[model samples]
Target chain A: MNSKSKIIPWHSRFDLQGITFLFFLLLCLGSFPALEGSGRDLDYWNNLKGFALKLFPPDFSILRSTLQGIWETIQIASLSTLLASVFSLFLSLGAARTISPLWVVSITRMLLNIIRTIPSLLWAILAVVLVGSNPLAGIIALTFYSTGYLAKFFSEAFESADLKAQHALRGLGADQFQAFQYGLWPNLRPIIWSHCLWMFEYNVRSASIIGYVGAGGIGLHLKLYAESADSWNKFSLVLLCMLIIVTVLDLTGERVRKSIRDRLEGKSSLIKKGD
Target chain B: MRVKNLGICVEGKWLIRNLNFTVRQGEFLAVRGSSGSGKTTLLRVLSGSITPDEGTIEKENLNSNECAMIFQDLQLADGATAITNALSGCLGRNSFLSSFLGFTAQEKKQAIKLLNLLGLSDKLNQWTSTLSRGERQRLAIVRSLFSRPRILLADEPTSSLDEKWAKVSLELIKKDVEGRNGSVICSLHDSHQARDFSNRELFIDSNSPENWSIQDVESKKS
Candidate 1:
């Protein structure tokens, strides 16, 4: 048969070129103000250098108080993370589409979205207004923020799990809870542990900043030192302590996450051998 | 057990309609059908996994907990050991807390015995994912038997087995049924196997007005 169709050019075959053009256009428009603001005089750099010189040989007289503040921050973060994990575990069952009914899943997800829409800083501010300047406020704020974040993550993990085992267990007359315990829990345990650890690490970072709202941590001290302008060395010391705490947390989190991943890999490799 | 005018509709389309059948104690019923003809649906309805849109099933002396199904996909927990998968069959009959605590010593002994009987003694503690297709099918049979069900519903139980393993699997199921004075309803594609292995046969067709028909194949065997 003779062909009557005309060939189309490569550029016309897909919208990739058009999409890339639009992306670059948007990037240029978005960066215009930032590019304009970035042009600064040499005086600005000299002032920054002066400020940097003042931060060295930090004041060691407030070391004990700084350590205490660090301990309070750790307490706020760990306690909030633990409470949030429990809250998220309860909510995820209702939020996961695979297990919950349509209305329950939709309602729970909507509530979680609303909770997550508000930033942790906003929650910290609100809690400080309601509960006064205390570690309790910081713990409450972080707990609320983490519950929303962890619920979304936990529900997604539960939803992606295979449902065949659950169906088989149900067919055998096991109730829904029993089926979840026997069929779904084994598949989800490792992921749940990983997500909780991730949330704990995140809370540690948030807890440090939440204290800026007078929630009782190193951030309050940092704010005080920075506001005074003469205590730049103490501020530097607090910053250093914050960096050290975050680094230690990140390392510990990485080690725990890696161990979990290794165990999961080992179990999966055993399963793969059967395949 | 008797099913009267049973009908099942999936996603607003009638899959099986107005079906009637009876399975006597110690009898094996073979259901024969082509692909997508709702053979699995019928077995699922009998096992009470899905509610029929019409009609009722009357199973005397059999609660839902007393029924076991051997799924065609061999729905074994891949992360668990063979013994754990087998032990799950007992979950229906045991108390919830007890089952969560895991199998009792006597239950474990019985599970091991059943596994040994199915030529899976060597793979007792192995992960189910590592089992061969035939081994997994045999393991499913072993799991089903561990429940000591009064009504066993097997969906294409031998579809993945060799002729030798298929026959052995069928024999094991038959022996379990006879020992418990229970009944079995199995779906199979092979007519020869259906005629040879079962005492009665039921044919289902999606296009047929009657939906299903039955024959006394055992009388022909005699």
Candidate 2:
């Protein structure tokens, strides 16, 4: 299309879209030469092969202890998720711009953003410094990180809920808490359950990793396996155990999320519609 | 409830100016106005959702819990069950914990009875989103009446209803207001409806300088 025909192409190929494509293309090539250096050393390849070879013959001896650690990780995720759910619900309530004061919403949202900006692993290390390498450390780190995400999710959910319903509730003299309870909470209930379940599953994975820093989980066992002489077999076994557990949780979470949807759609509610 | 010198302006244009009205106990005050005449805005201000630029409502120191508005759009919680939506009317009297746990057994029974009365017995468990427009309108009526408000401010409530349901719903409103010795300020497009059910008629004309006026209507003319 020519400019005179009313299809104005802003300088053809070097326009904004083309410039953006070119910029991305250059960035795409940025990692090429550095990535090429990764396979340059033959010795490193041999060591990797050797490392792979050592992770064989499942170590059944530590299976019981590994299961115990797995249980601890589950506990850590559950506790932190419970705490985070309560904290985030209230925070999100206050963060709802349509109800709460602007200054309060801004401060709470900025605080949540700052919390989310820090990685969970770094939070674990920080907690280890504060609480000194225990399950409590894992709980604290995951709670802080999960609160950040859940608050953001819940606030957006609250904002998107039926505004007219909220106004009606307020018009009837329901206070902020009551308004949230009746107005937004019913719609958000299913979503909150789904979000919390997903977060719990995620925290379980993070719990295992944070244990490497002595925060208490199966990852601590993996760390010890690395420190000891050629215990890569046990390390691989621990990873296999985590894989099984995470897979089970992921599948179960899917079913749970499905059930929540069914319930919300009125298949079977507490106040059953007789369906 | 008495509205005194009420005026509301939007976008530097006066929608209502120096409006005055009084609603006595057990009175059904029908508000008549053409489209975009600030009738809804007047009700919104009465319901305390929109603060007027100027004026005051003397509700004898009555708070919002004692007043309810049936919105033009209904504003029922669409994602919730019909029963849940009906029970929401109790939010004014019940605690947040009670609402969270669910309303009291009596509230549930009353809600069920009202739902049945409105021919919504089978829809108790249905989501509000699935209900037809007329059913939802009746549901909004149930919710408003469940609160037992001293003053019910309905804005074109029967717009979506069939002629039959419209009469049934309006009759319910009239019965509820008179039973409690309360008052209703309802807006309507049909002068026949305004005269049939209400004891007073109020016309708000936003385009003119003298925006609002009220006169008495014969009670139960139909």
Candidate 3:
């Protein structure tokens, strides 16, 4: 066995790729039946068009209030993401296999897995219950949700990093902290910044919806506008604001990514040496 | 440092066995063997990164962490500047808080001097990722020398350099370590280099671990 030789089935009548595609196609068809009882499928488009007609000339009357709501949503997203990033970094230092003992890694991973298993909406609902439905509830909820995801991301990244430099540092008499700082942190910085930025972007979108659970974001306004028939146009304005913010956040992330790339490539930037 | 009956078994194969040797102060010991002859493994053991399956190592006048290594792979930090890679050697000496304040002026000066000696004066602020293979190899050497260790373990340290640079670098290392009364145990494939720089040669037979032996370079030549 030279190892490079590719192994192929000697003789097989089975069309694996074809059958896999067919299975997914049939699965999609089978799942469509679940939507059968809704009965409004034919009228759904007509209802949307009618509702869309009410959204034109979005109510400028509530623009000021909606802007405030959006600001509050942005605040929730930013705070939660920052808090989650810091907390997750701490968690991952214990969870990463290279850093901690087996028991600590197992316990930390299990805790993150448990948190991740819970739905973000459920977390928001729980936060509302515990903290009395304030913006703080949204902060608490998103922090937990993002922490679960970020910990797993960071720990896996840490594990996948080449350990050669780390071993050399350790052999040269560096403590574990120094090894991480000088050896691993240089390579891990971009990945960490990218994850944090992504988390922040996702939180911005999520913050708007958590208010449905009374966790305090623009979703509370969305819920209020939906219930009051006369304010349908205002709902359109709120959605528009969210869309604008999401786009802006995406553009900002792109800029940050470019700068991080520039820094990594050693083009310029006197932001201190060492990665 | 001394070793007795040193053996390392990997996956039930004896990579090295019945090895007995001493690296006396100020000695330049060159280890020569074929590829996969356990040269790197032996240096790793000396550097304390690998535990020997069977051996007793004796050390004197040096702490466990006082050994520095120049790895064959260079093992430089990809995102860090060349200067930073050199300064990282001092991590064992400085307080943890000093990392926040950056390396001291004296430390920076020391690293710059080493970097310059290794022909990396212009690459001090260059990212390690951007350096050529030879440059990176030199940077690794500078890093190993930065610590002023009592023991220097280098594995194929000149593998990436041209013949001239290789001999020049080896000469510098030999001169410096011997001046400090430090011992150097370096793995090499080039027999001429081993003969030129080392006082003694340790040979490992990859085909038969039982044939491992140490000899004076002059005796072998004679």
Candidate 4:
């Protein structure tokens, strides 16, 4: 407590984080090649203008085709997300500390980590070989991708839930499985739904791109149009369609998430009202 | 049930050692000690949360299901209502699947009845977190009883409660235990309250390892 006993004054110590951040900034600045003439880097702007001009005056003629592609993309994402959620439900339970023991959880975690590390594009490519170049391949790929992402979140949710309640349930003689059902799952329901909705939104975008590798859907069509010299209009149409799909999915996902959150909050409040 | 020669150590230093106690049906034992004394640890051992390094315990009459504990913090699920939380105590008897699907009507009714008896009928569906400290403690005690355990172990159940609630809670606990013909072993920081409530008292003096003396403290008013 004495000033004489103070080994290091708080203000005198050098913060390594600040020094490291400055070093990183200097490195980035050093690597930047000076532009000969800087008038808003014309390439990105040209692409944007070209895209806008070609896409706009709104092609109502191509609307039907674009809507079909968007529909197909959504179907792929929705089916894939549903399947992935089922897989994640079981896998996460195995991975969670509450349900599974150490070795089981660790091994399941390692397997999920390996699966997650492989990009969904690679999974699509592999699925194309196994299941042929079709929408099924895209679905399978997205399913695997979502499983890895969702399972990790699900397990964390399980562990972060009120452990005291779980302990009380276990102490009362509930088996591990029962403890999960009564104590853990109810608490995780809203969180899992939120993650699931987010995954669905992600899958919609992923589904569009997976077609680039010939896994079948709007991406394949977009690639076909983009490669053709005269079909820049079609390419523009596909991009517009993908954008619309993403926007719609994002909005709907947000709505669903908000609704679920509100319902859960209302339930909690009602429970409080009883008190 | 008997806990023989129980010892507890924390990081090579012993907190309590060679503790011996036997609890029988319908008997009430109040463990009284100073703040730093090992009353809570002894209760944990009695409740089967801690195992002794040196001694053996025997449960001659009661099954594992016949043991329940009320933690000092109450440990009630704040998100759950009183009836739901009380019903949780009976989770030991039901299968995991059944409990998860939610309790049956009969079970709910029984839990409601129990809560009603504890003067919590009005708050049966109220979240435990909204309950006052005294109410939460009472809820936990009721939950422990719902487990249908032959022996109930409570640790400082009335520590957070006011004098009236404390007296009421202890009376409820005593009456409930007697009605079931079950034993109760509780640790109390307030010696006067312990003397007033429990039929018998065990005073803990943890001066040195393996040197504790369980004096027969009088529970009667002086």
Candidate 5:
């Protein structure tokens, strides 16, 4: 028998699109009357257009305040990621199936999943309610969120390491933790560091928005400007600043990731050469 | 070392049953058989990687520090260099933190000394991925001996080697085991090689011995 010619089962019954169409039709019937009397005249763009028009020719005089807000946002993001990375490193060990007992792994993974279910914005709001409107609240919320996300990936990296090295180490009378230190960590270090660098970039943007929930940062200032009608020009100026800040963050993150990869793969560092 | 009433089963088929054996200090015991004659399986069971279905392995006067195994595949970590992999045998002696930070000066010196004896001193820092099959096989033996275990169990140590390398490997193995006051139990598909190094040999046939005896008795002309 030619392996390539092996016959598979040929019956193709239903498709997903048919089921999706029925579900969508039911939703249309249920919410049909709610969309009535809300025509093109009541569209979002028509209502938001006048306010948006007043936002152009941004006030450059607010540069100092916007720069201060950007610095505060960067500080919050960097500190949160640092704290979260540390927490995830320890939690991931308990969550790793090879290193941890079954019950411990189960409990840690469950707790992490629950933590992840609470979105960053919700955690920020909860932090504000408990700790008052401060950048500390945003930092705490983002740190917890990043910890939950990073721990999952870290455990997965630990689990995917070669079992032969582990087995050999175990045979040498090394304990579980010893085997992990020698056998798994060396293999997983680069991948884990790369993921952490990527997560730092993600947290930077998320930190910007947490301020909108009254946790003070760039978004807090943005919200204040939007609230006062006279300061609409400052809103555009702050938006432009945010764009520049985000772009710089993105470029810095890219360079950091490349540098890590280059070092791990034994490549010559281009930026290091330039410096 | 002695194995009493040793048996092995895989997927409901018995590979070996009621097989008893012993290996003594300073002895080279060869288990000779054709391919698929339960030779490797018996070696694995002896090595403690594969547990027999029924057996009691009693190591006479064996200390925890006196057992080492060289696998057929060499089992060296490909990501590490030859010296690094060899030094891993001393991992039991070092603290976990020291091993993770790489070998100490003493460990490195010991690894180099062993690799020098194995005629692999020049290849000490060569990555395992770049090693030839025979080089890897020798490295594997060196790795096992680096721990200075009393009993060295090798599964087809010379099977992948050329004639010259094969003889060199077997001679090194005998010399190392004898030097350490250790013993060796090796399985071989080639009886010639087994006869050269080992003082004693055991043969395993796949057919039923009882049925063979019965047929011989019935077919006698006398």
Candidate 6:
């Protein structure tokens, strides 16, 4: 009987306008008929299936050449990553804001930015034009690219490191390099290894595409096979080789990173036991 | 060491203004101040870590290398072994090449002996992070001794220790410097303890007209 005096007010509005706006957006997108490619059709799917089926039996004739290409690619990536990491290590000291002078930090940062503005693929193209079509071109391109990337990463690492120890070392009259070696290096060792491994993994992947620009690697073989419509079997074999190499590299990188961490932790714990 | 018209300003605020004092050789001068009275700043300036805004400091036989400071925070590298951290004090005295190659056999032996004297013999290879706070403070003292400093600037070196340990730490520092005819200028919050440990005391008051003045506690007591 008391509820009879009460009235419910509906203050919430329906979202009809928002729903309509979304619907209109979808309708406008669907109206662009020219954007639809043949790949969306049944015939395209059937053709792709047949082509994939034909790749089941790969040609073993080019196995030797494929293996050689894989090895060359590995060499290019590994050497480039190694050299880049070292150069970046030195540059990052100047890039770190807390550790370096203002002018040095600004200049190093500008240089890194300029280098990173160019993509690795474009860098490879530039290297090819300058150095000719060789593994050296690929390596040089990767080195330049990796240097910018690793320098930025390392500067961030240095910035994140604790500066109390560095300050103390400086108070003890240590130069910048010595202070970094005794104070910051130990804290940054694990991070440096992780970043290097990640860069190596990235280099390995990018090494494949760099070969398309005539910087020697397995992508050169892939390009040749791609040009011939019936050479899907060879293309598939090359793809398979790339898959195996990438998987192996990923596994190796993980193992190495883990081992480094374990070794550092083990040494720490061993010292703790002495107490 | 003589300081004349020494002034230190941090970010436009004068922490120490026109401070003048002389620390004689073989003198144990205790600096007493309340919190935020610039005791640590004065020690830093004395140790040449911070350049004073005005005036100059003249040392009779001490170079920058001949002075070592035990920071209030005890800045030991946590990732390093206790021995390694202790050995870093020698870096200032050694040539760059020798420091790069690491401690020599004799240097290592000396570091071990210092650590042992501080009762940290069992923790020679221990990571500094794993050591207790008292142990870390002891390690800091040992590290400062490695340089055989002619003048030692200690900023609250015994703050983290109990009464017994504080006395031990102060005694150890006193013994080391007395034997070498060196001097120690340490900051202490406890005035009584300062009087007990040091022959002379320097009092700093940020709010007082005389910002700093020295008193011979022994003379006053006598």
Report the number of the highest-lDDT candidate: 3
| TM-score list, all predictions | 0.77, 0.82, 0.85, 0.79, 0.73, 0.77
Interface RMSD of 3: 3.4
lDDT of candidate 2 over A1-275, digit per residue (tens): 67689865767869788899999999989867786665655687788989888888768899999999999999999999999999998899788796579999999999999999999999999999999989999999999999999998888877876677877887777777777677776677888889999999999999999998888887799899988977989988998899999999999999989877876664544444432
Error of 4 at A188 (Å): 4.0
Tens-place lDDT per residue, model 6, B1-222, is 899988887777777778888888889999988898889998988887789888899988666677889999998777677898888887787777777777889988999988888789888987676688899999999888787888999999998888887887898899898679999999998776798889899888766524688899889889
For the second chain of model 3, what is the TM-score against the true structure's chain B?
0.96
DockQ of each: 0.25, 0.35, 0.38, 0.29, 0.12, 0.23
Q: Write the per-residue lDDT of candidate 4 for residues B77-101, one digit (tens) a residue.
A: 6655677778888888987567767
Model 1, span A1-275: residue lDDT tens: 33645656766744988888888999999888876555765587888999998998899898999999989988999999999999999899899998789999999999999999999999999999999999999999999999999999999998888788877877777777778777777667778888988888888788888888887777898889999978999999998898998899799989877855654454332432221
Clashes of each: 1, 1, 0, 3, 0, 0
Q: Please give the range of 10 consecutive residues that has the lowest summed lDDT in model 3 chain A.
A: A266-275
DockQ of 1: 0.25
Off by over 4 Å in 6: A1-35, A38-40, A43-68, A93-110, A130-132, A157-164, A175-177, A187-190, A224-275, B4-20, B53-56, B77-81, B119-135, B162-168, B190-196, B209-222
Candidate with the greatest DockQ versus the true structure: 3
DockQ comparison, 1 vs 6, better candidate: 1
Best by TM-score: 3
Indicate the residue-level lDDT of B11 in model 6: 79
B52-169 per-residue lDDT for model 1 (tens digits): 8999999887777788899988887765677877888778888888887777889888988888877887887776666788888888888788878888999999998889888888
Interface Cα RMSD of candidate 6: 4.4
Q: What overall lDDT goes with each candidate model?
A: 0.84, 0.86, 0.87, 0.79, 0.76, 0.85
Per-residue lDDT for B38-80 in model 2, tens only? 8898888888778889989888967669899999888887767
Fraction of the true interface contacts (Cα pairs closer than 8 Å across chains) found in each model: 0.29, 0.46, 0.48, 0.38, 0.09, 0.28
Return the clash pairs for model 4, or none. Answer: A178-B96, A274-B126, A275-B126
lDDT of 3 by residue, A1-275 (tens): 77657666654434898678879999999899797876655787788899899988788888899999989898999999999999999999889998789999999999999999998899999999999988999999999999999999999988888778877888888887788789988888887898899999999889999999899989899999999988889999999999999999999998888877776665544344443
Q: Which pairs clash inside model 6?
A: none
Residues B1-222 of candidate 5 have per-residue lDDT tens digits of 887877777677676777776776888877766677677787777767788898778888875546777787766665456777787777666677776677778778887887887678777766555677888888887777776777877889887788887887788888888787788888777766777787667666545311111111122223
Q: What docking grade does candidate 6 earn?
A: incorrect
